[model samples]
Target chain A: MGRHEFLESVAVADCAVEIEGDDLDDLFATAARALAEVMVDPATVPATVERSLELTAPSLDLLLYDWLSELIYVKDSEQLVFPVVEVHVTGGSPCRLTARLAGGPIDRTTTALRADAKAVTFHQFVLEPRERGWRARVVIDI
Target chain B: MKTLPVGDCVWEIPPGEKPGMRVPARIYASEALLARMDEGVFDQVTNVACLPGIVRAALCMPDGHWGYGFPIGGVAAFRADTGVISPGGIGFDINCGMRVLRTSLTEAEVRPKLAQLVDALFAAVPSGVGSKGFVRLSGDEFDEVMREGARWCVRRGYGWPEDLDATEGGGCLPGADPDQVSQRAVTRGRDQLGTLGSGNHYLEVQVVPPGGIHDPRVAKVFGIEQPGQILVMLHCGSRGFGHQIGTDYLRRFDQVMRGYGIVVRDRELACAPFGSPEGRAYFGAMLAAANSAFANRQLITHRVREVMGRVFGRDPRDLGLGVIYDVCHNTAKLERHTVDGEPLELVVHRKGATRSFGPGAPDVPAAYREVGQPVIIGGSMETGSALLVGTAHAMTETFGSTAHGAGRSMSRTQAKRRVWGEALIKQLGERGIVVRAASKSGVAEEAGFAYKDLGEVVDVVDRLDISRRVVSLVPIGNIKG
Candidate 1:
């Protein structure tokens, strides 16, 4: 299992989060979950819809960016708020990843959107492996 | 980095202060603003000075803050023949800008109906996360919007002919090629034409309060002569479409920059030669996104006019709902400017800055050419926003650029921790400002305490003669995205 927490000082105008996981897959899954919460309260969203995303990137850093960006596209295009995120990752020169996000169209009456995470910012973006696990920091433009 | 006071409200860092810097970096700010500026702004602005083919100096306006690549309120110009273009310099929301409209109604007339008007607008305009727009567009029609911008909206009866004339560049940036934009961008943006995306975006109904007119002469020329005159100010951008375009190019540029032998200290500042195939694609795609933003604001304007007409029992035209001006805060354009007494074409990037073309410049609309292009600078809804006019001094000092707003002085998380949105709403209501936000948390994040003093920032430029003050607008009604 992985965990994430919001950072207060990393970004002044947007939301920043730091995630920790036991491995690459856990790290990516944690990142997705963190990204999801930044936009809306996940607890209020029901896991009624399913979306599958697959992408490849030259670096793990870019792989994470692409995954989060793809989700933003889907969320904006379909007007869905994902509460559940599942990510599978394979580390290599060209990183590969697939995600399954479960959510549905936002019912404004029931949901309180915190912010519109417009895009993932590369400012101070970091992804690294630690002795015990992995850690990544992401700044999302709200 | 060591800096010297170059002029009143201006500080300069020589090229020797940083490795790879080709020119000096200048900060257009007051002594107090300079002292409080975050270190990241200094670092980022100096890094911008290192880019290949930079002209004169990289500039940080008074409202500057740290951003992805260039600082917010940053501007830089590059040689058209040899320089490069990076999405980082233009920001995720392409042409994310400000627009102001003048109305004949007075504060006295609007005050009684302020709550109803705000609520109607809040319901009519889609906002917040995962918000979709009312006007749906097919793939082909969306493409036309990219090419024709606000003109297409008028052609579709969403706007009037005169609206285009008040818009910057007639609301259509040239060289927008639909083919250059990606499918994902179109999918994300096709339906978002009239939406105000969350995160500091808003539509405010304001009035020129007594003593708010800083330059009475220019205010009269700009259709804001009276203190009680009402105005509608909208802040938004291209939405998901531009965000997708910026993301796509940032990744693409990172991959191809090494091939072009271009190196930037930060990967976020990735770039390729302006003349390269890669660069050409992004430029066209960016212009398309910029045009979409123009059309988006125009669509929102149409909705606002409809709501106003419905509320006040008069046609919008009869109410004198005319666009005063529309301006972009995030953009990169190729324009001809003189450098060191030589005239040359340059690609000027304004990330969180506005173009302040002074009086008599050919680009200024003929109606405003003698008075200067109107610049709308939005502050927090609780504090007041301002209307200003450009000056020739800006043309010489900052590539005709000026600050966009009072940049956030506190982090969103900190702001949320400090105040409860539920309480902030009541606080604002007591102050006589009606606010309707999609989310309470969003409102808290935008509390005036989290932002710098806009008056001080405006004073910096006013004193420097970059952008002169015209009128200050106090919000009577606001709908936060």
Candidate 2:
């Protein structure tokens, strides 16, 4: 576990975020939490349902993009919000990821929907190893 | 970073200014507007000039601003046989556009009941984050919507057949193959057909003020004969469906780019050759999403008409609720344009820009052929909007394209920090503009100061003769997602 914070980008109309962790797996998990926080208050989402996803992408940056995009798609199409997200990454080159997202159905009374992130844009998108941890910058198209 | 003055309100970066740029990059802006623009716009437009098969130049409109790859208000044309198609060039919101409907009622007649009408409209149309629409489609029917676009809605009684005539491309782009659309995209689109998704999308009730009409003859042709005439303008597009398509294609194109031996300065500009298998597939899928957007707007129009009828106590027809025009700001259309005095088929990509075909163009509807295509430019709620008609100069200089809106001058975060949503709402209310939105923070994010002035942007295009102003619209009420 590490830290994730929202950043600012003059190039886009929506939110930009920076996530860091001890390794690739940790960074992915923290990034998911950051995305969840963007949509609603994580404290309000009840972790009553669980969804598991296996995704693959050509590169690490794209893997993060696909992960976030899948979460957004699930949030919109299934009407579910995830409060807890776990990611496990293995192998190399074309990386593989297995993620488990736990949350409940969205209810206006409990969930204060903040923003609907349409997709993760590749504009200035980066995922790289930094001193002490792995750091990534992603701009979410809202 | 260097540019030379090419014409009044125009600046150009020569082809050799960048190492791989095949054509010049042009920006249409007054000196004041250009001074306010972010430097990223220059980088993005110049990068676009380097794309494969880009013809003549990569052009930015007066309202241009930095975007992902192509600047917002960016326009370019590529040779049909040699050029490539990129999702970034068309944008995530496929056919994200503006539709304006005129009514016989005047502002004076609706002023007292403005709030009530706004409430009715807000209730009728599903809006805000993750909101679903009243129309739920089965998987099979959803496929039909992807194929037939607004025509599907007309067949289902959502809109009248004549409404399509006022829409660009007749409210549907041909060559849409439903099978090319992914199941995930379809699933996301199924319940969101008539929804106005969040972030700058809105439905507004506007009035033509006494001084708003710029040209009396053109205004009359556009159905704006008298001051205080009420009109409804809606800005929206394909919801989750287009987002999914854009996401899916960007990733696929990035992976395939290496095989095509194509390299781009930005990964977001990923593309495939127009004749390539990947390019054709994405084009088909993009058209499906474009059609989905047309149907979404048509259904929303139907909802607006219903609300108006209820509020006015008259049939929508009797109320004179007829569509003046619907034009998409984000799209890539294959059309014939003359390059170097030779007629050639080209794929024109307009991201955050509008098509402004001049009078007598075959694509213009017969009713408007003598006046040219009506271009709808939606400004922020506080500043109001404008209607302009294309000129022959637009076709010759910009491939029949023009500015889409008063582009953003500040980031959302900056806007939110500078303006309190509640206070801004109060200010607008004091000015006789009723504003309703899902979130106050969202309202603040789109504060009037966050965007460039519409008047200046319109003035530049008008002075340049790219698009001539017809009328201006002052907002009376608006609903934002």
Q: Name the top DockQ candidate.
A: 1
Candidate 1 chain A: worst-modelled 10 consecutive residues by lDDT: A7-16
TM-score of each: 0.99, 0.98
lDDT of 1 by residue, B47-100 (tens): 899898899999999999877788889999999899999898999999999999
The RMSD (Cα, Å) of candidate 1 is 1.1
**For candidate 2, lDDT tens digit of each residue in B1-481?**
8988988999999988888898999999999999998887898899899999999999999999878878899999999899999999988889999999999999989998999999999888877766899998888899899899999999999999999999999998999987778899989878998988878889999999888988999889888898889999999999899999998899899889889989988888999999999999999999999999999999999999999999999999998999999999989999899999999899999999999999998679888899899999999988899999998989999999999999999888788789987898899999999998866677888888989999999999999888999999989898988
Chain A TM-score across all models, in listed order: 0.94, 0.93
Considering only chain B, report the TM-score of model 2: 0.99
Give the residue spans of candidate 1 off by over 4 A.
Answer: none
Each prediction's DockQ against the real complex = 0.78, 0.61
Query: What's the residue-level lDDT of A80 in candidate 2?
Result: 83
Q: Chain A of candidate 2: what's the TM-score?
A: 0.93
What is the interface root-mean-square deviation of candidate 1?
1.1
Model 2: residues with Cα > 4 Å off, grouped in runs:
none
